[model samples]
Target: MKRITSFILLLTLIIAMVFPAPFAFAAVTQSAPTTEVPTTEVVTTEVPTTEVPTTAAPTTEAATTEVATTEVPTTEANTTEAATTEAPMMTTAAPGTTNPDTVTILHTNDMHGRLDAEDGRVIGMAKLKTIKDNVQPTLMFDSGDAFQGLPLSNFSKGADMAKAMNAVGYDAMTVGNHEFDFGYAMAMQYKQLLNFPIISSNVYKDGKSVFAPSTIIEKNGKKFGVIGVTTPETATKTHPNNILGVTFLDPVASVTAEMKKLQGQVDAFIILSHLGIDSTTKLEWRGDNLMNNLASNKDFLNNAIIVLDGHSHSVIENGQLKNTALLAQTGTALANIGKVTFDLQGKNATNITASMIKEADTKDVTQDEAVKAIVETAKANFGKATSEVVFHNPVPLQGERSDVRTRETNLGNAIADAMEAYSETGFDTAGDFAVTNGGGIRASIDGNKDVTVGDIIKVLPFGNTITQIQVKGTDVVAMFEHALSAPTIEKDGQVGLDANGAFLHISKSIKVHYDLTKPAGERVYAIEVLNKQTNKFEPLQLDKTYKVVTNDFLAVGGDGYTMLGGPREEGPSLDTVVRNYFKAADMTAYQSTELQRILAGTASENVPGEVTTETPTTEAPTVEATTETPTTEAPTDEATTETPTTEAPTDEATMVEDTIETVTTEQPTSIQDTPAASVEVKHDNVIPFDQAVKQKDKSQHDAKAQTDKETAHQLPITGEAAGTGAAAIGLFGLGLYLIKRKSA
Candidate 1:
C-alpha cells in the first residue's frame, strides 16, 4: 500500500512537471497585459488617406531568390489585369508552421524616377524586383524622392512611377518632397493610383492629416506599426504653391503624440522617414540629432527597430547613426537596398539586425518579367528618348561642378554657344550675346560617349524653359561682376571646393576679363561683344541695350540673376533648345574651347590674346568640338552620408522608468565620425519661391518616448522551459522504476 501510494505520488509529480507550476502561471498572468496590445485605429482616411482604427488614446511606448521571368500571357483582355495585379511577396506566416518571430524589410529611396533598366548607374525597377523577390517574409518600402527626376516618369505625371512600384509589390512608402513637384492635387491623384499605402504623420491640411499617419502591418503573425514621416523641408523644398494649405508640425512632437496614441498595440516600430541626415539642416530637424538625444533611452527608441531614411541622398554605413544602430539611409538613385530582420517577441528583442545590398553585388539577381514589362513600356512610350543616341560626342565637354562654378570649361562653352546658336534662329526677341548661370548646367558630356536624351536630361534635369530678355550693357557688367565676385581661395588647402551657382558662362561671341584682386561687385575690368560682320571683338557700349537668350529660371530671379530681365518672352524648353542646337551643329563644339571667353587671371595657361592686361598670357588653339581633345576626367561625387546636427528637446516628452529592458548609454561627443566626409550634392528641380517661405524653424525629439517600462518578473525562455520539462520527465521515469522495483 505504501509503495502504491508512493508511485501515485510520483505519477502526480510527473503530470505536474509536464506543465508550468501554478506560481509560474501567476508570473505569466502578470506579464500577459504587456503582450496583448489593444487593437486600435491609427487614422487612415478615405480615398488616399485611409482611416486606421483610432487607438485607446495618449500613452507612451511604441526571399529566397527567384527571378520570376514568367512572361505575360498575350490575351489582350487579360493584359491590363496581369500588369496591374499585385501578388503580395512571400510575407504571410502560418502561426503554427513558420517562425512567426522573424520578418525582413527591403527598402529604397531617392529613386528620382530612375525607372529605366538601362539608364545611367540606376539598377532600375526590374533588377530591384529581382533583388527583392529573393528574400521571404519581406515588406518593401521607399523612403521618398521617387517620382520626379527623369523625363519618362515625369512625362506621365507620376503615373509611371506608381505603376512600376505597384508591379513590384511595394507594401508602403513615405511622401518625398519631390512628390509634390507636379502639384498637390496630382500628388494625391498619384496616391490614389498606387496599390500600397502612402503616409506622412506631419503633413496636415485644415487641421487634419493630408494622408494617413501610420499603418499596421502583419508579418509572420507579428504586428509592425509603421509610422511615416516626411522632412519638414518639404514645406519649402518643393513648389510652395503645391503645399500651400498643408502644415508640417515639429517632427518630435508628432512622434511623441503618435507614440502616445499607439501605447500598447504594436510589436515593433518602423520610422519610414524622408527626413534626411545632413548638417545643412538646422539642429531641430535632424535625424542624428534626434538619435543622439535618445541613444540612451531604449524606451524612446520607442521599441523602434529601424529608421529607413532618405532626403539627404546620403549613405549611412553599418546602419549606425550616432552609435544608434537602428538608423539607415541608402544613397540616392537606388544604388543600394536596405534590409532589417527582427526576432521580435513582445518588447524583448535580442536578435535584430540591419544591412544594405550594393549595386555591384547584384550580379546574381534576376528581374521579374511583369515589372520589366511595365518599365520597358514606360520607356517605349517615351520613345528612344533616354537610350537612343542623340549625338555621338567626339570630345568630352566639362560641365563639372568644380570647373563650371569656378572657371571656364569646354562644356560650359558648348552650352553658351548653344544659347547663342539658338538665339540666331527665328524668335520674337533677338540680338546681342547669350549668358547663363553656370549652375544651370548639372553634368558633363563624357567625350567618346554616345550622348542620349537621357544624358541631356541628367545634365539639365530641371524643366526650366528658355526665354529672351533685354538688359542694359552696364547692368550686364554688374551681373558679370556679381558672377565673378566670389573670393578666390588657394585650391590646395580649401576645406570645400569654391562653388558659385551664379557663375556666368558667356557665348563665344563675347569676352570679359576679370581682375580677381579687385573687390566684390567690381571684378570685371573689361567687356567686349563680337561683331558678326567683322568677326572682331569690340568694346561694349555701357548705355547699349543687349537682348540675351537665357532660361526662364534666371528671368524670374532664380539663382540670384534678378538683374537681367524685362518682359519674359518664352521660347522652346532649355533642353529642347539644346537638342535643336545639337542637331544643327552636327556635334560642333565652341571655337573658344579654352578660357578665351572669360580670362580669369589663373596660371599662365591661357593668357588672353585680345585683352592687353598686365597678366602674362598664352593663347590656346581655337579648337571646335573635335575628335581628339585632351582627356580630362572630372572627379565624381562620392556617395554622401551625413548625420544631421540636432538640439535636445525642450520638453521631456518621452520619459519612462529606467528598467532592465532599458540601458544607459554614453553619448558620443561628436557625430562627425558617423557618416562619410562632407560633400555637396546638388538636388535640382526645386521651384523657386519667395524668400519668406523657407524651411520651418527649430525641432524637437525625445530619447525616452515610450511610456511603458514595467520590468516583468523573469519567465523561462522557450528552450529553457523545454529543457526543464525534459529534465523533469527523466526524473519521473527514474522514480517509476524505483517504485516498481520496491513494490515487486
Candidate 2:
C-alpha cells in the first residue's frame, strides 16, 4: 500500500509541475500581448497604444493594422498602459469606412472695449462662454481691438480687458490699430499678462517680430496653422508716438512667407486679420483686397481656409473670397459672434460652413460665473460720477462716428466752434477758422437730453488741446486738398462718400466749394474767408498769411497736413473747451447753427497741375499695393507628430479642467527662433523718436557733409608731423647706438 501511494504522489507532483499557477498564466498573457507575434510586434512598434481601445480585440488584417497604429509607444509596457489609460483619438476605422473630423472655430472682432454692454442684447464675454461650453472640438480667437472704447477698458489702459479675455479663454489674437492707443509698452504689458498668444506676422520691432508670427494647435489628431495679420495702416491709424519702435511689413508678403513655413506642418490654415474688408481703407490694405492679391497664387490659397477680419466695423458673413477661402467679420461692439465649422477629411478641408449668432438671440444663455465676477468687479470699481449729468443737451447732436468721419454734420460745426472760441482766448486774436479731424469726434449726444462728463469724455477721448498756428493761404489750400485727397467711390463719374479719418470739420469762418468731377488736387473750385477787419467774406489770397485755430494734434501734423506747424501755444483741453462753451451758452435755449461751411458739386472744372499725393512727413511708413509671386518652398509633412494629449479648454471661464478627449500634435519648428521675415541680426538697435526724426530730415543733406568730414579726418596725424617725428627718432637712435658701442 505504501509503495502504491508513493507512485501516485509522484504522478501528482508531475501533474502539478506541468500546470502553472493561474496568476502566472494571467501575467504571461496580459504583460506581453503586444509582443505575442509578428503582427502584434508590428502594432507595438509602429502604432500608438492610446489610439486603440483596450476592450477592442483585433479580428482581421485591417483591424490588426488599425490597432497597430492606435498608440505608438517606445516600450511594450508603455503600450499596454496607454491602451488601458488613454482614450482613442479617432473612431474605429471599420472595413471600407470613411470618417471626417469636425472642428469648430468661434471668432470675435472689434469689441472696442465694450466689455459689459449696457444693453443686455449686445453680446459679451458671458454669453460667449455659454456657446463655448456647448461646442466641442472648438477654438476661440479675436481679430483685434478688444479694448480702447468703453470707460472700463480705457481707464485701465486695456489691462482690465486683458484680464477679462484671459478669464474667458482666448486662444490667440491679431494686433489692431487701437491696440496702440495706450502705446506699445502698454500693449506689450497686456500681451505678457494674457494666457494666449498675441500674434502678428507683419508687425516687427527692432528687426524682430513684436509677437509670434503663427501657432500650430492640434485637435482630434489634426493640426491647424493660425497666422496673424495686422493692417499696415496701423502706423497712421494710431498716434505716431504710440508705436515708436514698430515696423509693419506688407500683410500679403508676411502671410505668404509664414504660410510656406506652415504648409506641410499643419492640416489647415486660418488668418486672424485685423485688416478690415472695406476697399477704401488705406490703399489695398483691406481684407478683401489682400485676399484677391493672395489668390493670384493658387497654391497659397489651396491650404488657406478662413479669414476672421476686423477694423472697418463692416459685417461679411460666410463670404467666399476668390472662391478659395471663407471670410467673416462681425461689426463693432460685439453685436454678433461668428462661428465656422470645418469638416476635414485626412489633411484637407472637405467642407466649411459659416454663420453668426446675434447677441439678442442668446438672451436666455447662461453667463459664465467666473467671467461675470471679473466684469462685476470692474463695473463696481468705476466711479459713480461717470453717470452724473454735467450739462443738458437742448437737441440731439449729429455726431455719430460714421457721420462725423464721412460728412459735414452740425455736431462737427459746434465742436469746431468751441475749439475756435477757446483758441481765441489763448491767442488773444481772431483766428481764421477752427478745424478738427473727424476722427477726433467719437460719439454724439441726443438732443434735449442731459449730457454727462462721461459722455463728453467718450466723444473727445484723446485729451487734445486748443492751439493756434500762423499758416500761409497757399498752405491752407494745400491742407484742404490733403483733406479731400482720399480715394472716393465712383458713382456715375461723380465721387461718393468714403470713410476717411482725415476729413476736415471746419468752423463758420471759412466757406468752401468742391467739385467731385475734378481731379483730386483741383477739386476745390472756390474758397472764401471772413475778413475780420472788414467783417465780410473775401477771396483768399495765396500769399496772405492767416492765424489758424486748430487742435494740438493737427498743429503737429497729426493728420495729413504737414505744413500745419506744431502747436504754437496751448489752451484748454478739448473736453474742457467744450464744457466752457456749454457753460457760457444758455442751457434752456441752446440751438445748433445751420452753417453752410462746405458745398459739394457734381460738374468738372479746370485746374492747374497734376494732383500730387504727398502727405505730411510723419514717422509712419508709406504703404503701396504691389503684386509679386512668392518663391517659397512648400514645407514637408514631417514637421508635426501626433501625441495622446488632450487639448486645453479654450473658454476656461466655464470649465477649469480640460475634459476634451483629443489628439494633439507638436510642431517641429519653433516660431520664436524662426520668424517669417527673419534675417541674421547682430544687434537690436532702438532709435529714439526725436533723433530718428532729425536723422530722417537731415539724411540727404548730411550725406555729403558727413563724407567730406570723414575724408578730412581719415588720417589721425598729418604727414608733415610724422616726417618731423621720424627724423628726430632717427637722430636719437643713432646717438643711443654710438653710446652702446663705446660702453661695450
User: Which of the numbered candidates is closest to the native, going by highest TM-score?
Assistant: 2
Displacement of residue 235 (Cα, Å) in model 2 is 1.6
TM-score computed on alpha carbons, candidate 2: 0.65
**How high is the lDDT of residue 450 in model 2?**
79
1-744 per-residue lDDT for model 1 (tens digits): 868777787877678686654444222334334755333222212211111223221122320111112211122121112211221122444334256666677888778777865433557888887776666435778888787665667656568888988988788898887776666666677667988878776676655566666677766566666777776655434433345556565554455445445547676667787876654344455655444443444454436446787776666655764333277777766667778776667754545676778766776667778888888888776654356566777766666544566666666666666776666653554446777776557667776777777677656655555567888877787778777766555533432213455677777667776656556665565667766565445667777888877765455444444465457566544665665566556343342343456764422123333422221122112212221111110001100111011000000001001100001111112111111101111111111111121122111112222222223324444444456666777778877877878869
Candidate 2 — worst ten consecutive residues by lDDT sum? Answer: 647-656
lDDT of 2 by residue, 412-443 (tens): 76677666666554566757777888777777
Candidate 2 Cα errors over 4 Å, as ranges = 1-100, 428-430, 487-495, 586-595, 602-744
All candidates: TM-score: 0.58, 0.65
Worst 10 residues of 1 by lDDT: 646-655
List the global CA lDDT of all models: 0.56, 0.58
